[model samples]
Target: MSYNLLTSIDNNRLKQLKNFKTIILNGNNFTSFPSILYQFETLHINENPLCLAPPNDFINDKYISATSNLYVQINDKYEEKLFEIYQQIFIENLTSYDIENLSTRFKLSKTDMNDFREKYSHLKRENKIEILLNIWKQKRGSLANSDALYKFAQLIGDKNLVQKMQKTYLLARKIRI
Candidate 1:
């Protein structure tokens, strides 16, 4: 499956494709090479090893030549900006109740909302916000850019936070340009 558009894969699924001569996991967010893929004759994960540290074990492995290199930096700057916006909101003296309210503003699906709450219940308010933002980012995919973040602040009806985030977003854009 060269380009099945998979964002993630699991060990069980890899087992099913074990007999294939070549496997490509290009363009996904793998922090390290999947161990199950080591036996394949040709393995490709061109855009992966997204985490700061690159996997070094298979650097000399003959069958896995393509994945031998390392990523110098994380690629998704948009996701980083979204997290920064949420961090600003959480740090602006928002009360616990207000932070809890903002969590629901993402308009996540019913299942996602419930799953998010249950999974992140033990985290601090700030961590919970970060987790919520991650879920929203995953749900929105490429659409979760600065503009969508601005709209989310508007939806929260916090004019001051909206203005601050807007300014930061614009400054980031200018710097990037």
Candidate 2:
């Protein structure tokens, strides 16, 4: 059977490490190198044995090298990735005006609405109706169309407040432009 090399320390079958081309160690229980690990072409050993250093040959080897020696000094990449994750998390929380401002600020080719939907599918499902209502109200404007006012009334679910807001909107609309 083909094996996935990126096994956690808790995997009982890590004994089969000899069968894989690469191994990613993301655990702390490892006190020393497993003899089976040397068979791998690449090894990603992270956050273990802070005092221990890789030998010069291991550092120079084309097939096997330590991650510590390869420094990724990239501020721009980190910033871009951070922005992507943030957009993924917070897109639904933002208003249309907020999204437009963000698009302008970032010079994005497309709005992050899709990314948001993908990342927060479960949360979106739980709040779908309310979120859509909020978005519709935001798009339709609290003071614009009569249909929008009716929808806003449905959203508020209050007769008195809806009438008051509709009257206020009418009064405001009548004022000099």
Candidate 3:
């Protein structure tokens, strides 16, 4: 639905043919900055694709400088949407394309979320206890996700994990009551 925000007109080179004094393409997922539009007196594309790369490509300034916030804002927006999608997937028993999409779309193999990345690594290593604990930390407080987590723990034959998750859920329920 949000794709309608940009139409064929937005992506068309004809849009650049206009003798406009200024051009603003912020928040647009433009893969390449067109050379033809460089004649503009003002151009603002900071939050778009070009800013996602290392700052050195554009300028020598460090990320702590003024240029950094634009990229950070994009990442923050992405993370917020990812969280919402995760919750919805849990509720609907849907599979998350998070891992795949992040790789293909965002071009991120790994992120700076250390705790979460470490937990994911633990799952990859099949470190049973640590993986179980990470699942609880990640999904426990939520209703649908917690149920899915319980089932996963069962499927893995970790009775201890299932009991631990049950204990926390029951304790939280008691407190809520």
Candidate 3, residues 1-177, lDDT tens digits: the string is 122223113337646557887877666554344444444667676444322433344435332454466556655554444334333333333223233332233222344244446656545323333333334444434332444545654554445545655665565344323
C-alpha TM-score for every candidate: 0.46, 0.25, 0.35
The residue ranges of model 3 lying beyond 4 angstroms of the native Cα positions read 1-21, 31-42, 46-51, 61-64, 94-177
Query: Which rank order by lDDT, best down to worst?
Result: 1, 3, 2
Best by TM-score: 1
Across residues 62-83, which tens digit of lDDT does each residue of candidate 2 receive? 5333334432212223333333
Cα lDDT tens digits for candidate 1, 22-72: 877776655455566766777666644243333455555553444423342
Please rank every candidate by TM-score, starting with the best.
1, 3, 2
Steric collisions counted per model: 0, 0, 0
Query: Cα deviation in Å at residue 83, candidate 2?
Result: 6.5
Lowest-scoring 10 consecutive residues by lDDT in candidate 2? 70-79
lDDT of 1: 0.62
Candidate 2 clashes between residue pairs 3 or more apart in a chain or in different chains: none
Q: Give the TM-score of candidate 1.
A: 0.46
lDDT of each: 0.62, 0.41, 0.44
Winning candidate number (lDDT): 1
Residue 140 in model 3: shift from native, Å? 12
